[model samples]
Target: MNDKTEELRDIFTDVTDGEETVTESQEDTRGSLERDERSTEERLESVVQQMRERYGFDDVSLSDDELITVAKSFYEGDSDAEIADALGVEPETVFEARMALHLVDEDDADEVDLAAIRNREEDDATLADEYDVDETQIRRYRRIAAAEDESRTANDRYRDEFDSVLADSELSERMTTDVREDGLEDATEGMETDVEF
Candidate 1:
């Protein structure tokens, strides 16, 4: 029994010799974890450096809660002063945060009236004035409306063509059925001369 156990051990060792050892895998896993940790630290450092440069701070620090507040303020389009007042930070700091983050663009047309621009009753300048946005944004909105209209028109044309094709197919089927019935009647009449029924 001892000799048999030794032979089995030898076979197991030979089979496993070509594979990676447990220690090597553990070391590789450790190396990967260390690399990921360093990468995360470097990214955080870069973000902090950007914030510092934008806000003109010698040493800037932000808690997670402060960051969330800043993001919310930015999304709401609050002024730098308002954001600073809300976050209890300097206006200069809010300005830097806004410049660095840029949650929304100056030319966003979310609140603009696109239909008025499409109708030509309202020009881009007029819409811009009404919406209190840049004229370029109004023009962008108009272009988007025009593209949407074009797509709708193309879709309508395709639908109409499909309906027409369906109608024509039905008409052709009816005509073929009528012709077959008339031919059958004519054939029955022609064969009546040779029948006595």
Candidate 2:
């Protein structure tokens, strides 16, 4: 061996208490990681359950499993139309379900007069006319306004928990990569050329 190699070996031996090989028991190192023992799904489900109990998802049409899907898709930054396609429901249904779960899109909130919706005694149709948007849009804005009155932002309501659980599991990166790859594949699926370059 070269002098440098010999010197590294000697140093390693000295640092490792004269042992040629450094060994550590898995148990000795495991606790330092601070990992959650639960599976990703279990962690997400626990968070969802906590939300369901805390918020009392009154009049929400989605099942428990569907709600979980909504949470996951929302955390993945999927649009309501995309989430609706995944859930095999209409976008309006998904929108209402999102509102019920306090998953208000900031853009949606920004588009409407939340204060007017909050203080007015007018019904959704009237609000829609005043806002020059559809009744569904008015209804969604009203729900967002109500959630604001309750002092909860989208993050405070549920996104933070979903973000935490997915980020911890490293699923967020994987899912995002997968979605991007799928979109790229779909975009190029039919553009192959017969001629060789």
RMSD of 2: 10.9
Q: Write the per-residue lDDT of candidate 1 for residues 98-138, one digit (tens) a residue.
A: 33333223443357655666787776688788878898776
Query: What range of 10 consecutive residues in model 2 has the weakest lDDT sum?
Result: 26-35
Best by lDDT: 2
TM-score of 1: 0.29
For candidate 1, what's the RMSD?
A: 25.9
Question: Where is model 2 more than 4 Å wrong at Cα?
Answer: 1-35, 150-157, 167-197
Q: Which stretches of candidate 1 lie over 4 Å from their true place?
A: 18-79, 84-102, 105-110, 113-197
**Candidate 2 on 1-197: residue-level lDDT in tens?**
99999999999999989999877666544322225667677877787677678777776778878877887787678998999999998887777667665666678688766876688999889878878899877777777787666536444746556557764456655766787788899998989668697
lDDT of 2: 0.73
After the best TM-score superposition of candidate 2, give how far the Cα of residue 64 lies from its true spot, in angstroms.
1.9
Question: Model 1, residue 170: what's the lDDT?
Answer: 49
